[model samples]
Target: MTTNAELAARFEEFADLLEADDVEYKPRAYRRAAENILAHPSPIADQLEAGNEEAVENIDGVGDAISSKIVEYVETGEIEELEELREDLPVDMAALTRVEGVGPKTVGSLYRELEIQDLDDLEAAAEAGEIQAVKGFGPKTEQNILENVEFARTIGQRQLLGEARPLADDVLEYLESVDAITETEVAGSIRRWRETIGDVDALAAADSGADAIEAFLEWESIDDEIESGPEKASVRVGDVRVDLRVVVPEEFGSALQYFTGSKDHNVRLRNYAIERDMKLNEYGAFDVSDVDDPDAGQRVGERVAGETEAEMYEALGLPWIPPELREDRGEIDAAAAGELPDLITQGDIRGDLHTHTEWSDGNNTIEEMVEAAAERGYDYYAIADHAEGPGVVGGMGLSDTEILEQVEAIREVDAAADIEVLAGIEANIDADGEIGLGDEVIDALDVIVASPHSALDQDSAAAADRLVRAIENPAVDVIGHPSGRLLNEREGLAIDASALGAAAAEHDTALEVNSNLRRLDLWGSAVQAALEEGAIIAINTDAHQPATLEYVRWGVHTARRGWAEPADVINAWDLEELRNFLH
Candidate 1:
């Protein structure tokens, strides 16, 4: 069966192969079609199979050529042209492109010059100084490819939360129609909101576990059924593995708590429970104080609580802990002392402070982005387009004169906008931590977000001091994506989070938990350490388009992982409070 994910992946591959073969406009069309297909709510295969050709044609970017390719793939299970392109290049496009700077053209060049087919081949060529000899290639590109090879090799071992969570939600929705199912939820790392997930795990509560498992296998999104048993099943959805476990309605809570663990967290909690003469496991929480051996069996004593997750914790006189805080990082102690923070929620964000407009590589115009934010009921919004400097790519960043002109443009729009619109600039923090903004430009802005775009390979101490210098710059209001890391793409920078956080707190500057899925900088542990010094955090989407303003959801959960409360996040504040902080 063709799942949306599988079809999108094929087109993505088609685009890469076409690009490698140097096909021009067609590649972008295929890629855009693939993205739309992945995001399209209905299945193209089902539409094609049902003879609804118009539905497929109506999809954005799916013109005559792309639509026919979809039909051919659906009807015959293959596209003849894609196979030919694959044969011509015959390289692992996905794996090869995972290296930071290696694109289709680079892949085409390397394959033509050095016949590099995979990471192994690329690494061999780079190590032997072969890549630098190729035209338009040099030592820097070769070394970067070599350095990124291992990370690229291990890229698909885990799925991004942004990708997997939606699939899990689909699973829950599918299982809801099962008559026997009493409850359902995502489990494991996905539930904990880890940045990457190994498998999409889900749980269902039902009187008949076998019936629930049967229903799960029939899910329309499933690409293939891997295994199914009486109480559990595993299946492949797109490229990721999804596992479903069905338990008795009575034991649902206990199962959820046991499965939604970080191993260390469960171990610590189990030990804590043992001290209270209680035994905990998937079966249920048990009062084994009078039992001869709590270790004798999985369920050795009278079950005290198992009907609900809260009861499972209540059995031990503790409040139910949020899954994001269950990483064995003092959460257990905090819970016991009633000190667990009221973690920030997605609803708390009032506006986005780090958005872009077409003025700086954004897809939408300034008016469009601000209107979209207004539609989401944001109390305020800010336009912090990139400022021209060393790392600004292709001269995309704005010049000082342009920024000032844009500032005037924003003010004119702000007068008519439903929400308060702040004029801002995302100035590049150079290697020496200096921003390129002129004093007049800074004076005109409502907020200034400083970010590092180059020299990301600085040593830890240098990285820390560089960021500290930015934090101490009175003109700067927020530091964005402090580490500059792109998950699975590159290990961007290694900064001393504690030192940066302290400097930020001292200077009253905010550190950002950039909401872009690839750059959730100031991740949980770092945020927790920084907040210990009373540094404020701002969860900005760094959105480049109107649609991506919703990326703030990823940012909110990321802040929660750091045990952030409503008070810790700046944009979560109302208009006045946010303005006060920005000033």
Candidate 2:
């Protein structure tokens, strides 16, 4: 069966092939269709199979042409046009594009000039000094490609949390619907809410393991069954691998603790148990100092805790730790000292400061965005559209005149809205650390999110200085996506976090944790450092659409991982408190 992920991949490949062939508008259309397809809540195959082509076409950015292709692929398991395009280019698009500086155009150029068909072919040509012979290819570009290709090869693939979590939720809901499964939960790095997951681990408490395993295998979402046993099963849901383990209800707690681990955390817990003459395992926690064979049975000697995860932790003489704090980064000690922080929660956030509208590249209009924020019960929302400057693509940025016009539009929206809508601009910070917007324009706005959009290759000292200067700007409320890094794609700016954090704290400027999955900037460790240095954090979704407002949870969890309290985040404050900080 074709899943949304599979269809999205094919569409992306189609886009890459079209771009390689120098096809103009269609490539962008294909790419947008791919993104919308991935973000679609339900499986695309189901819609196609139901013969609802109109519903499929209704997907944002998907036109009749793309919808027809999706239906064809669903019915025939292939798209003939994509096949023909592949036959024409015939190079490994995914592998070649993984190289840092190489893009589809470069791939097309290399294929035509040197007949390079794969990474190996490209590497051999580079090694032989033949790549520089191509018209636009220089020796430095070839050398950089050779160096980056190896790193790309070594880095294994991991699904982003944004993608993996939905699949995990589906699995959990499926298991809960079964009569045999009493309790079910997802484990592994997903439970820890890591940015990426290798494979999903699910656990179930059942009266009979065989019954639970059978129900799991029968789940409709399973595309392929990899393996199955009396107590466990592994299946492929779309492109993701899910492993299910069933244990007797009595042992659910110990089993959950064992599976939901950071390896380091479990190791520390085991050592701590040993000091108390107890044994810890997946079956249950046991007092084994007097037992002849501690491993004699699943529940050896006297069982202390196994029914619930809280019980399992209580047996270890510690309070129940939040899953996000299970990283073994002083969390154990903090729990022991009864000093665990009251971490920030989703409900604590009162507003979103950095958002976009159709005035920039966002899909929704200013009124639509404001209405969405009001619906979400936010006290205030800021319309921080792109200001004319670096990294603004396709003339998406607003000029000074346009910014003034937008301000009036924002005011009109705010007048009818239940929530406060602040007129703001996402100004670009130039390489010299000056904001692209004029001082008058900056001061005219209720908020300013100054971000480093270009010159990301600066050295550590320069990057730190650049950010410090932005923080020092009296009108700037937040330094957005401090490094501008995109997960698994770009290693954006390299700044001295301690220096940046101190400067931000001193200047009363908040550092932003842009919650877009691709750019979860001011990630856990950076958030921790900044918070420790008295810097205020703002967990903004950097949401471009209403659907993306849900991404704020990702930032909240990431902040918890960094030990940020509600008070540490500016968005968590009340309207008056937020206003005080902004001023």
Instruction: Tell me, by lDDT, which candidate is best.
Output: 1
Model 2, residue 311: C-alpha shift (Å): 0.9
The collision pairs in model 1 are none
Please give the distance, in angstroms, between residue 79's alpha carbon in candidate 2 and its true position after superposition.
Answer: 2.7
Best by TM-score: 2
Residue 181, model 2, lDDT: 96
Q: How high a TM-score does candidate 2 get?
A: 0.94
Q: In candidate 2, which residue ranges exceed 4 Å CA deviation?
A: 48-52, 154-156, 291-300
lDDT tens digits by residue: candidate 2, 481-539:
99977675566888766778899999999999888877888888788788778898999
RMSD of each: 2.7, 2.2
TM-score of each: 0.92, 0.94
The local lDDT score (0 to 100) that residue 114 gets in candidate 2 is 91
